[model samples]
Target: MNTKIIKLDINNKMYETITAKQGDTKSRFLLFNLLDGSIPFSLENRSVRVYAVKPDRTEVFNDLIITDAAKGYCILELTTQMLAVAGTVRLELMVIEEDKKLTSNIFYMDVKESINSEKAVVSTNEFTALMNGLAALSEYDIYKSNAKQVPGIKEEVSNLSSQLDNMITLKLLMDIDSTNYRINDFIMVDKITRLQNIYMANFLRNLRNGSPVTIACMGDSMTYGHDVNSEDKRSADTTPCDNGSRHSFTRASITYPESLQKYLNKIYKNNVTVINRGYSGDYVKKGMERWNKKHNANLTIIMYGTNDSRADYVPEEYRGNIDEYLKWYEQAIIREILWGKAVVIFTPPKLQSFGDLDVDTFANGLIQLCKKYNVPYIDTELFTINYNNINSDGVHFNGVGYEIFGMKSASVFVSENLLKPQYVKGGTKLLNRQTVDNFVVNGTYSYSATSGAYTPSELNNTGGSVLNLNPGSSITYSFYCEEDDMFVIPYIYTGADKIKISLDFGLKAPENSIDASIGKGATPLDNNKSSLEFTNSGTLLINKDEVFTNGVECLRIPTKGWHTLTLTNEHSQSTGGTLVINGIEFMNYDVFASYVNINKYYRQNYLKYTSHPILGDTASVSEIRIKPIDYLKLHPFYYLANTEYWRNPPLQLIITDYLKGSIIYTFTIGNNSDTTMFHGEKARLGAYTGGRTVSNITLDNDTREIVITFNSGLTNKSNLLLKLV
Candidate 1:
């Protein structure tokens, strides 16, 4: 395909205020379209070029990020030398194709001195981060001798170390925007927060199906789009329902909510009503009163704590005060729920700490409330990586900053496919697996491109052997955990049968290496070990019945982080079978309450393990990775069902009763059109906390579930296993 520029954007908006300064550091985006082609057709082609020309046609910022092309755009970082020369310059964006210059768009820039106390802190922080990142890359690069990289690292470290001294110099400098950058004690929060699929997901799904969606934005000034005059040092009025200063800095045309609406309509081809119910000083208690039934909505986005962070209230008994921050916050939340709306709370963007209340406390309180209410929210305070992108007042954001916030907030919907017809329902697509602290075996297995048939060990590289499975073929994994939680192992195995697979902890045992072509349970080289039987149809985990007697068990590892598990396929005599091995996942279970499982009968059919909350879809565990844990945090759950295979509508099962030995949950399998429930001959579960021995698994003649009764050890009562079988 030939090169094409479908669209172009600057700071994700048609208009953005950019400033150039003398002897300062800065960056701008000259991002454009042209995404559907090979790298050589665009990125590698030295495609676009940008220029900043003065009134006299003097070109400034000749240095641009044109040569740099990413997924869709370019990040133009200005040279310190370029920014040092300040002027009101015109920036022209263009595309170069086959020796021709094509104009994209242009904008005016107010190039002035931006090296004030506020900018200094921002610049210093960015510089420090860049330096640290480089240092890390250099230190971790196994082959650092390739280019004087080690020397470069030392020089950069020295330079960044020296820059730290200038932070004190900032205190003596003059002009500044509302300032707060505790570098010394600064905690790095997540730049993007993704959590459990909560209420809006359902509402969003309805919206994409051409159904109407109304989002209520309620909070204080920030939610109302508070904009401070950095130059004049004057604050806007707090009570204006619609004000110029509340929008893209002037005019309520493109405030965050407005921008959000624009974005939704553009993408969904349907109008999504975004009601702006923000007032200047709306704190928690006062905000709760506005949650009237008259203000109904499908989804509500509440961003409070701005006024509460600095509000005056009794301090001594604050924690126990009925009208304290969390008290009113909880009341407001329950109000929204009562109003029949799903809520998404934000950790009101940061502010300079005033006295007793800190943003962390405010933000964390919302998290605690979410758990209490079983709700969902954006963990903004802890996971926003755009600190340097904030507007003048560190507390509030302008359009550019708000634009990023809009996209990030919108990401939850976008990422979850809520803006489209629900296709491929449930489960976060494992497009790419996380290898953080993970192990991978390289170059030891067969691969396929047509089916995207992957091999996990291909990507994981913790200095291990590649996995090549067949009869008597197996590989072992060594992992370390910090806490004792039940975990499940999910794998992608295509077409195989009667291949005895065994799981062991820590110690290595006999090698039963076999070929992929064929082999049934191989002839005993030693003794008969209990193992899960694998078939192309699916796998049957080691039935504990034989496990306790034969000493071979299913794939459930319960131990501390410092542990190991070995998986081996035994040699076979009968025509074993041929199989393709792909990815295998290690995830812990946290949803101990109630959920459905793909019983052994359903295992061989159309479904793999889809993780749930408490054990986030991520490979990133919350507790005990680096060392033993004194504290722990759980993850949000994920939903999974063969949306395609099941012709029926979605099915939900709730726990009806729980006794000491037996607990009962309800479920309805199939599309509801058929009475047949799926059953698997073999199954591998992620986690389980019941009796070591199963006397029997009985399906209710009344409902649809194989009621399992647990007896013995784990008496936590809250440890319900949540993994695919």
Candidate 2:
């Protein structure tokens, strides 16, 4: 006989559910998907214990995978291999009552193996409820709080409370004292709690409604609830005996989402489900992905972007990627909200002003974008501001922060406007006109095909036409003609996939005499690699060597599509350049550049950027070039000129400060396990060395870790070398 436990209501009393073998050789597997509720789990009298004897006087075997389920479900598989035919197996889903009475109920199953036939599909509601009942555990919290008031409830509460206390202690050590095992161990603690809450809420709600309900809690780590426990003994191991011991708050009973669920259920006068889908170190990019999983939820709340502003990417670039992320995220939220036009709430990162200008800028930008998208943006930041409260870390919040934030968001769902949309979806009539007002049209160059020929949207200083590539502004050229005629000029354009113009063209067309006339427009500097040649089917190459400050490359393109462009280092020198094109198309290509020349001081104060090193570092600048690989951009850090930053997606590079200059030190980083191609066309690291990928490089004599940092705010495009030693 196999041991099994199930839970089902018997005359409105809590009972541990059990399944018995009914004229069967073996017991089958039982799985349950519980809904959101207050009680952690319901089990009465330890109903899942091993039996000394089975029906027909046979031995019993117990096998179970008893952890919280991934979703709102639990599974129980049993085998009767050790039991005699017609053996009896007994179990029940049970819960303790206020009167200190044990409850038990038999678990039932309807398994009918059949061939193809017109059979009605069985519903999963009843099966899920029974399974949830068996696995129900005590909400040690509720038991502890109320036990003091009730006489004779001490021993039961102590036993249940001790188990939770031990679990809480273990969870605390799992976080701060990572040396005991691995850092990943503590991550599962939150995951388990999330599942427990979802299961408890669903199971209790099922009993209340006489049906099943699904709950989901969606957001980031804050939504996951991070607490530092003071009672955890394990944290002591990480510190020295001489260090004074201190108590910290553990993550055991910290439950913001559960608190919200409880509030909602009480307010609604019925059972409501809640699931925590919060990830530890996730942003909007990750939050959107997790929410896409199939779940039965009439509502969802999205909280994200608290972690994105800290990323190493440039502020402008980060905003660009975030823009695309939000577009997709908004669409997904709309689908969920409109599922019967269900209610949805979008919460922004709470407003806590960081000294960094970039973070504030990014957050404000996101807030504005959310307003335009019509997603309800909850102002979490305002709570802290209004209450004059502060968390010790100056980054995260205290208990007050959680309480205020949770209440404000919950209030949105309670309001009558929960399902109402302020503006209709796809209603962009106002946005388009608003954008046009701020467009500030620079110059419009139309291609009429009247003179020789020109690319669509081509702009130049000739034929009485002019368009300026301002310091931070650009204009698009539209194609109105149908002919495939080509246009030529004295500049080049590089897209995400390939280069439109190469430097070798000027050398090939000697009669064009573009180089001789360079002084008249753009002169060649000593650091600028002016030498030009052709490779790979007349592909052009430009090599910038020993260039420490700034450089520029000019070329002409008469064709379109994708082209291959390469740049290799001649000698270590910090360098990068802006590509100038005469008759090229500019659509989705966005160019961003920045590097710090150690010699340049800003207002006599040293700049501080964690992502990159300051000026006057040992790593000298080397080679830098942009190439097309995919529709996305790929920046490969390199040093050696001959080395190739293969136009493959997902290119990796290792930049280090060695051999004095970036020309001879910088190299590409590759791993044998890296086979997946990147989604973008090319990779461009602004402050980069030439084409040299090395296995290891020594920095500052003591063998340091080599890593390249791309600093976007710097005007010099100088690569920063960080030592991981």
Best by TM-score: 1
lDDT of each: 0.40, 0.33
> Which candidate number has the best lDDT?
1
**Candidate 1 structure lDDT:** 0.40
TM-score, prediction 1: 0.30
**How do the predictions measure up, each by TM-score?**
0.30, 0.25
Worst 10 residues of 2 by lDDT: 425-434
Clashes of each: 42, 85
lDDT of 2: 0.33
lDDT of 1 by residue, 270-331 (tens): 54788877765567655554433336478888788766755454243443232478766755
Tens-place lDDT per residue, model 2, 394-475, is 4444454554445434433332223221121111111101122111112222222223222222333333222222222222
- Candidate 1's clash total is 42
RMSD of model 2, in Å?
27.0
